[model samples]
Target: MPVATFSLVALDCPDPEALAGFYAGLLGGEVQKYNDIWCDLRTPDGIRIGFQRAPGLRPPSWPRADDNAQQLHLDLTVSDMEAAQERALALGARPLDLDDDGGERNFRVYADPAGHPFCLCRT
Candidate 1:
């Protein structure tokens, strides 16, 4: 039997509201701010993602195995890869790795405003 149920994933960011806003834009969620140091987004699909303020927190480096690396990332699936890519960029997502093996690969990597890496996967 399971010991505990799944809960939200909280990310450490410089600004909780700003980071939550970025995810809210990309994921179509409602941002709820409890305070200046904490905020969370409830997605349409019912996933809760929390953003907590972490002053002086350094964003992880992508594709690295060193001390600072991509500790975790989110994968979002989209029906239209091109459109999703454009939308993500418009919402302040920086392209980390868009080389999808000449359109054969099904996923592309990007970094949110706070530099958290996420992937827009083709469905």
Candidate 2:
């Protein structure tokens, strides 16, 4: 038996609305703002992601194992890697790992506007 069912993943960032918008654009979601400091996005695929205001928040560092390690990352499945990469970049996702063993890998890494790392996985 499961101890708890999944609810949502909340991220701490300097601007909640901006982060929410970023994800909403990529994930095809409706963004709701509770206040200047809080925002929630319910993706079209039915995943809920929350963004909370954190003054002086430091975004996570990717491909790292130090104190600034990547604490969490979202994996999004896609059909066309090139098109998805272009869309993600257009939506403010910065490439973290473009060289995935010269296309041998099944995923690519990127950092969201808030600097959290995520992957666009090939389906």
Candidate 3:
């Protein structure tokens, strides 16, 4: 039998370096060049976040009245929701849902620079 463990989460981006930098800052990670077409971040937890170049990549549309279905998204945990949201917005993230009254302090959804959905959850 063979055992497997999660190693990395890779996302397709038009510019690997730009996306890599965004994630690195968000996760407190360090970015490194994997190759000409790829870049990766060595996160504090040892998990890698990889970015692969896709010249014609189109970002997923989410949380809109006529939004295209999202393929996938990442959830991030933070202490202060407002502050985190502000920081993310400053970093090129846009708010997706304006009204989220979930019972529990789950998360707030936003889109990255390229319009890919991601979340900021209460930690």
Whose TM-score is greatest here?
1
Pick by lDDT: 1 or 2, better one: 1
Q: For model 3, how does the per-residue alpha-carbon lDDT over 9-96 read when each residue is reduced to its tens digit?
A: 8888888888888877788779999787999998898879888898888788775434556878999888888888888888788888
Clashing pairs in 2: none
Q: What lDDT is reached at residue 107 by model 1?
A: 99
Off by over 4 Å in 1: none
- Per-residue error for 19 in candidate 2, Å, reads 0.9
* Candidate 3 segments exceeding 4 Å error: 64-68, 102-105
Q: How well is each residue in 5-116 modelled by candidate 2, as lDDT tens digits?
A: 9999999998899989998888887999999989999998789999999998788988977888889999999989999999999989999998878779999999998899
The candidate with the higher TM-score, 1 or 3, is: 1
List TM-scores for all candidates, in order: 0.97, 0.94, 0.86
The per-model lDDT (C-alpha) reads 0.93, 0.91, 0.82
TM-score of candidate 3 against the unseen true structure: 0.86
Q: lDDT value for candidate 2? A: 0.91
For candidate 2, what's the RMSD? 1.1
Winner by lDDT: 1
